[model samples]
Target: MSTADVTSSTNDQKYEIAHLKLVPKRHIGRMIAAAIVLLILAAIVRAFSVGQIEWSYVRDFLFAPAILDGLKSTLIMTVAAMGLGIILGVVIAIMRVSGNPVLSSIAIGYVWIFRGAPALLQLMIWFNLALIFPTMGIPGLFEFRTVDIMTPFVAAMLGLGISQGAYTSEVVRSGLLSVDSGQYEAARAIGMTQFKMLRRIVLPQAMRVMVPPIGNEVIGMVKLTSLASVIQYSEILHNAQIIYFANTRVLELLLVACFWYLVVVTLLSIGQYYIERYFGRGSKSITASM
Candidate 1:
């Protein structure tokens, strides 16, 4: 109740508050775990760098003419297959979302068949399609023997493109479905045609969701092109196999192929980052405002 008693109590409280620790406790366990992981990673890097990897052979063949040719083929195939796949995917996704039961069922069946089968099996089937149908053509139109047209290139394209379309259709369908239903209703009320509505409103908004996955699919398509080698298509891995088969430097050739694949995928990943950012700008702005 005295003035000195009150002053003494306030000063004691201030001293206690000032002495309290504010910093978070260091997580010694996490620090120790991280150190162990780094040490293990360093050991693995050192072992591989100094191991019997034939780095000289990898360097020598990295830019070899045959490898370069194979790289070119791989790039071309990836672009062509992805282009075809995306177009088919967009069409199929639209069909799946259409009101007609027949169109939706057809799209669903196509996606089911392609996605259910392994891509390699599809390639084999396309390559050996002659067994099922010696000739392929319109019923009343000119026909060609399946074997005559079913080259490695054709088989690879058909297999990769169709298979990719199945997956891409799902991606596109999800993106489309992510758009608010009210947006569709608004577009319809504004006298927009279905195609015009998709082009101007739904798709542009859905692209923010679609671009990332589509980019991943594009990068995956690059690697998937390697499977064409099974059918003897002259992609990067096929060329690497040819070189190593004669030279008995399999690991070196494989490393070279891996280096190129990493380079291509890295480039693609960078492009994807930029594309995602571009499409995501509006969403980011809306989020920030909210």
Candidate 2:
């Protein structure tokens, strides 16, 4: 090509490049949406701050002796119930996955019944079990009046633990199932007993998959303990109810309960994050490298 023609073509390209828009178009709609969201949030905050919710009562009763005692009860119940539930869940999960059909069927039935029933109803039933069975024990061996044994605490534990076990069994079973069949075969080839294999190999690996869901269940159990209040178990909600019933500071008392629940749930969530991180170390390292 001629020098003059090449120069003219280059000048035309430069002119076009200079005239072209560089920046992407602004999203006016998104900006408008964000403004709308911020306004709504501000409005909500203002409404709650000025609403009939007595903040003074919430502040005063937040750490009151009764509320603290109720909070303690809630924490204790949650821990006990979750612990018992985990133990029962492990056994039931094993049974569900076992070779024996009868064992599997029994586990299935337990899960079905407990998971299907309303937790509140289960609590009520346990609390009022004396009505159904005035006495409970081995006929010739020993006997006790149901009312004597099934106090609010016992009833709450039985109801929450048993019900939680049903959900936890499924969580555990899912985690167990996530393991590769080859892992089982390898353990067998190494002459490890099924129990040893589960304890040393399968469970450790499966826990990576299980920890998050189990953590969630633990948090859920904390909230579920509130339901025990229906049976006169003095959990946070029940204590709040009692206070409100006496003083008629219903919303404030409820806010107190809400505050404690959020605090507990937040702590549990933090713990769960650490647990998840610990279990996820191997996978995360590999992912990061990739």
| Weakest ten-residue segment in model 2 by summed lDDT | 281-290
RMSD to truth, every model: 2.8, 2.7
Clashes of each: 0, 0
Question: What is candidate 1's TM-score against the reference?
Answer: 0.91
Model 2 ranges off by over 4 Å: 1-11, 14-21, 284-290
lDDT of 1 at 240: 99
Q: Write the per-residue lDDT of candidate 1 for residues 57-148, one digit (tens) a residue.
A: 98899999999999999999999899989999999999999999999999999999999999999999998899989999998888998988
lDDT of 2 by residue, 95-170 (tens): 9999999999999999999999998899899999999899999999999999999999999998999999999999
lDDT of 2 at 51: 94
Query: How many clashes does the backbone of model 2 have?
Result: 0
TM-score, every prediction: 0.91, 0.92
